[model samples]
Target chain A: MSALLTDDSIVDLHPLHIGTEEDGAVEVGRADTGMFVALPPEGVALLRLLADHLPMAEVRRRFGDSYGEPPDLDDFVAGLHECGFIRAVDGVPWPEGDDERGATEADPAASPAGGTTMRGIALLGGLGPERLRWLLSRPLLLVFAGVWLAVPALMLADPSLAPRPSDALLYHRVLPNALLVAVIAWTLVMLHEFAHALAARARGCTGRFSVGRRLVFLVGQTELSDVRTIARRQRYAPYLAGMTWDLIVVLGCLCCELAAVGGQLPRTVTYTVALTFIYQFSVFMRTDIYYVIVNALRLGDLMGDTRRLLANAVRGLRHSEPAYDLSGVPEREMRIIRWYCVYYLLGSSTVIAGSLLLSVPALVRMLRIAADGMASGPAAAGFWDGAGFVALVAFQFGTLGYVGFRDHRRTRAGTAATAV
Target chain B: MKIQIRKLERIETTVACACGS
Candidate 1:
């Protein structure tokens, strides 16, 4: 028993208490993380009869005859430990009188990897069809969508369309075609998430919506249920649905371009749609393709695993008590993560190289265009060359910085409150 | 004995146990 304890060195272990009934069955009330227990009959009876104060051998002897070779109680305890039902007592201190065992929220980071509380969002809980119709009929949303479609249509029809000063400054000089790509990408992203929410609702499950960072990039989405509970096909839908919509939009744009009776709309719309689709397919970054690869390999928490591997490698090099603890993880998962690390190491380099190669030419062209615009700035054509370019760049950068700062401040505030 | 209401009412009773008893 001591040997088992020694091998499974559980530090800061928090043990739970089980209650027994007159029927001689035990019910484990999980107090930590608000998780409940669902134990088998044999395990329940064993827990009911066993003495909390006695050694393992005594408990084993009581059940060994009937259960044949007697299921290893040590193994049972280890399973319980893994499930967070019990904790090792040795080398860990407990409060003097606290017997009602439960987990405390002392560590804010203690939730499962990538676990987060959804803030500023609510679930669309079980809304009836009638209610949904009413919600959709809201005047503001309908107006906005109608306006989005109408303005573009009107612009396409009008032949006297000169690039507005703002448009020229923002799109042409500052951002080139990339800003159009971003706008289109954003639409697709939103539509993709909408599909997930719709599917989740159809399945009678409510989803929690949040606008936050998925790794480094900011995204907005609703996480329906635990990914573990979702079917493989169902999980694949939300990730790919947006891309599906993007393809559809691109096709629509192409149709418009091919059918249009000689106008700027054809080129503008086609270029916008194409750029959006290409931007989305840029998979080296955490995009649809990244998720597809991660999910296909059944690698849950790949990001967390990558972080742990990096930390462990650093620790091993220094020869310290690996500040990154691998003891809590199962050996099988750890082996899988090792493979993932090797994959990431090779894959990330290729992605970076590809991005650099693709971006450099585009960037050079943009710079050349900007330079030419600066040189040919005439007083008759309004001051939209260098000055306008600077303002647009400043605006984009300022907005991006604000978003990053807000996230940083929020995380810091949460950490500070947890510390208190 | 209980007082009757003007409107038809259903009366409910609860049982309590004492350990000393």
Candidate 2:
């Protein structure tokens, strides 16, 4: 009970971070506790009254003056306590051990990637959110968009600037070409992730870069949760910024390719960027573009929700239940989910199939070439190079297998715990 | 007006780079 009948029945709340939501809601939370909740307008009013340190009786009277009916303050205050918003009740400190909230701060970038939990290391000049004031300007966004557009515009004018599959082989020695692509592509990848962190930071989000593996491929990710405080309009830049960087890079590489005297280095980079651009369309893989689509549509937990819907459908097949229950999903979002689920299904199958067909054969062909090189003695220049290539392939697939197995086991354990 | 109290949300946003085709 709130002990509201007394004259001095006052309650104190922890400092709250209150902000507006895109959908006419309110976001309230403690940044330290990492606990946030979305509330309607009247709830915000009630919170404001409590935050002003009003006594419960006065709070109810003031709230009733604005709204026709008084809020169920006991229930509301209880909810606040559950949310870790209560600091004290009637001069008594909030209990420490009893709350299930686990209110300790979470390391925003603490990732369990590669089977290790570690804080994401900041790289390549991460400026604080306040110092990056220009990121909020509209003109800077145009400059970014204009540069992205210029890449294709120039390629359209001169088709020679377009990337080709032939550009994959960059140097006389296979090892040097592989090394160069790895170096440049990874450097580009880091810059791409850094762009995301910068945009997020500029919008008052703190995040760090970490290396993680997704399915069969290795990836870099930025862990930022505070972007939720920003509206949907502001999120697009952070999500699409990486692709914009890739395009800007493609444009730069294309110009450099033209300037170079018959050298393939720039073209090689253009091809790598082009391949990455194509990869952004592989949305089922939860790429940056997936987040863009998610934010654009104002959908919550699209990936996890759709995955749950599918899992439920599989479990309910004998009962003839539908694949998804549309009761909880909003009508507008349901339309997108219908289309997106289909796209996800088709896209996932296509990617798995395409990778198996194309990448497997490509890997095999490369291995065959390396084997021919290895057939010769150490006197042959390609012998050690072939060995290096073989080792790289082994490491790539080796990491993939290990991560995949770990994910599978974790999923099974989660399922078992859910059953229990 | 009675305002509804929703559950706490963990607004985790991960910006990942995976252009793997």
Candidate 3:
């Protein structure tokens, strides 16, 4: 017998942002809730039919007409229902296992699928609401643009303003000085994220401020909910807001450094500012500049596409089956992806090499100094300094290790769930 | 009136049926 179906069992489609994947599959994302699912062409066709709110028999009939055979409508609908993509709009009860799934209205951040978790309380909901809206207005945006253009020109004219590796506030006496720098740097990062939130708010979009781990580092994130709906031009404000704040800080520090050339201000101040500026340009880490590039080119998933393209190239060389199929990528994006792959590889190599050459050596030296000081005895002043240094290093690396471990477990769980 | 108009425009542009039709 056919499954019990009711005329009142209308399916309400969740607001989804759809995009085409590289392999010609359809990717549908509920941006606000962060529910993402990929589907084959036939699955997408079924989704379209469901979105029409047709009765079960009508959907089945359409599916049969389109595919020239009977389709597993019940299984497909059940999967969608399970994923929280559709809901009953007519107050009708769902089939057996559906009600047992419980309510799906909980915060997506708390139970994010694919092993991602956005932890921490939101500090600010809407910041400087009216003032920010005014600042992001078209006329004021021109002023912002002028300032953005002038800062680079001003920096270029001043040879002292050029960012250099020596600009990093790394000194021999590294305990108190390093701690102070770390505090200030973190404050600046917070301000950068706040700028993004403000810009998003200005464009009538809500930005949620939270601290989350991105791979190894604890990052300040502004989750902009309405970005997909907003105009591309308005979207630019939030994407570039963090970098704009960084530039302002850099310029301000440069001015101060210029004024107090030798004595009043520590060179470390200017150096720290320059270091932040340089860090933003590390597009390999999906920094602000990376988003600017992606938005400017109007390409979806440039990083993912580039990675897949490179992986496929390597596979081709070894005559092994490629892990990613790139045939569905549009010609325009494919060309851009090819160039991006080259740049990304070269830039990543440079960053990796720089870390090995400079950061590793500095870390090793500090570790040795701290170890030696500890060995000298607790009575020595060096012992306290060494202990502080060791604590700081342990705190930083321990946090990194813990975050990486959590991410690994989440990824394994997600993969196992998908396999099942 | 302006806010309502803007909201309508946003809904028209952002919200869409799964079928392009």
Candidate with the greatest lDDT versus the true structure: 2
lDDT of 2: 0.65
Q: In CAPRI terms, where does candidate 3 land?
A: incorrect
Worst 10 residues of 2 chain A by lDDT: A103-112
TM-score of each: 0.50, 0.74, 0.71
Candidate 3's C-alpha runs over 4 A off are A1-9, A16-29, A35-49, A59-84, A88-123, A126-131, A161-172, A208-219, A258-267, A314-318, A376-380, A415-420, B1-21
Write one digit per residue (lDDT tens) for candidate 1, span A1-420. Answer: 334453324323344444333123233433322222334456764554342534455556656665655656656654454444444344464322111112223221222212232222334555643544332334843543554465446447762331232321224434434444345445555665565555445443344454433222345445443322334444554455444544455445445645765354444444444443443444323445556665575443444556556666877889866554445344555787787677656665664565468644754665566566667666523234444544544544464455456545444443211100
Write out the backbone clash pairs for model 2. Answer: none
> Per-residue lDDT for A324-406 in model 2, tens only?
44354546766776677788788877766887998789778878888988899789978887887878777666766765564
lDDT of 1 at A124: 53
> DockQ of candidate 3?
0.02
In the range A215-245, model 3's lDDT, one tens digit per residue, is 2234555555346555555677887887677
Q: Model 1: clashing residue pairs? A: none
Which candidate wins on DockQ? Answer: 2
A245, model 1: CA deviation in Å?
A: 1.5
RMSD of 2: 6.4
TM-score of chain B of each: 0.18, 0.23, 0.16
- Pick by DockQ: 2 or 3, better one: 2
CA deviation > 4 Å runs, candidate 2: A1-16, A21-24, A28-37, A40-119, A122-126, A213-215, A320-328, A371-379, A401-420, B1-21
